[model samples]
Target: GAISYVSFGYINKSVQPISINGVQPTENNVKNNKWKIWSYEHIYTRGKPTGLTKKFLTYLKNDHIQTTLFNKLGYISV
Candidate 1:
C-alpha cells in the first residue's frame, strides 16, 4: 500500500511558486526515500495542522513513520 504524503506550505517565503511534485516515475538521481524533490513553494497536506513548528514536526513524524514501517517490512532495496 502506498502511504499518504503530507505537504508543507511556506517556510522561507516566496511568491507564485510552483506546486510540489508528488511521487516520481523513476528513482534515478533521487536523494531520499520515496524520491523527495525541492519545490519553489509548498502546499499543506489535507488536514495538515497549521502553525510554525507543529506543522513541520507533523510532516516529519509522518515521513518517519511511513519510512520506518516500510523499511521494517523490507521495502528497501538493501
Candidate 2:
C-alpha cells in the first residue's frame, strides 16, 4: 500500500493486504516460499528476440534493474 500510494493512487485502506496461511507477503518470504500467493508472468516472442527487444529484455532481467526499477514500480521480478 505504501508503495502504491507513492507510485499511484490505487491503494484502498479499507482493503487490507492479506497473508497466505501464517506467512506475510514480503519479498524474501515470497521468494523463498515462506509465502506463496503469486502467479507466473510470461512474455511471448515470435521466433526469437533480437536487437533492441533483446537488449530491453536483458536490461529488464538485470539484477540491479530488477531491484531498483521493477521492485520500486511494484513489479515482481522473475
Candidate 3:
C-alpha cells in the first residue's frame, strides 16, 4: 500500500460546509431535518470529572459562554 492524499474536515464559516443535493448545510436546515450530514459532540471519561474538566464543562454550559463564545466560534449550542 502507498499513501496518496490526505483529508480534513471543517465546520461553519471557517470553511464552506458541503451541500447535500444543492441544499446548503445551515442551522435552519439541520433543525428542520433537511440536512443530514452532521455529528454530535460528547464528553467522555471513565468516571465523573473532579477538577478542571468539571469546571470547564460548567463554563461551557453557562449562558454567557453559550451565547457569546459558542456563537463567536461558530458552534451551535445543543
74, model 3: CA deviation in Å? Answer: 1.8
In terms of lDDT, model 1 sits at 0.43
* TM-score (C-alpha) between model 2 and the true structure: 0.68
Error of 1 at 27 (Å): 22
Candidate 1, residue 46: how far the Cα is off, in Å: 26
lDDT of 1 by residue, 1-78 (tens): 223333232222432223346565232423354555533224455575568667665664586754775345423322
lDDT of each: 0.43, 0.65, 0.66
RMSD per candidate (Å) reads 14.3, 5.5, 5.5
Question: What TM-score, over all chains together, does every model reach?
Answer: 0.19, 0.68, 0.68
Question: How many clashing residue pairs are found in candidate 2?
Answer: 0
Error of 3 at 67 (Å): 1.6
Residue-level lDDT of model 3, residues 1-78, one tens digit each, is 332211122342444445669887776786688977666567886688878888988888999997787777656666
The whole-model C-alpha lDDT of candidate 3 against the native structure comes to: 0.66
For model 2, how big is the CA root-mean-square deviation?
Answer: 5.5
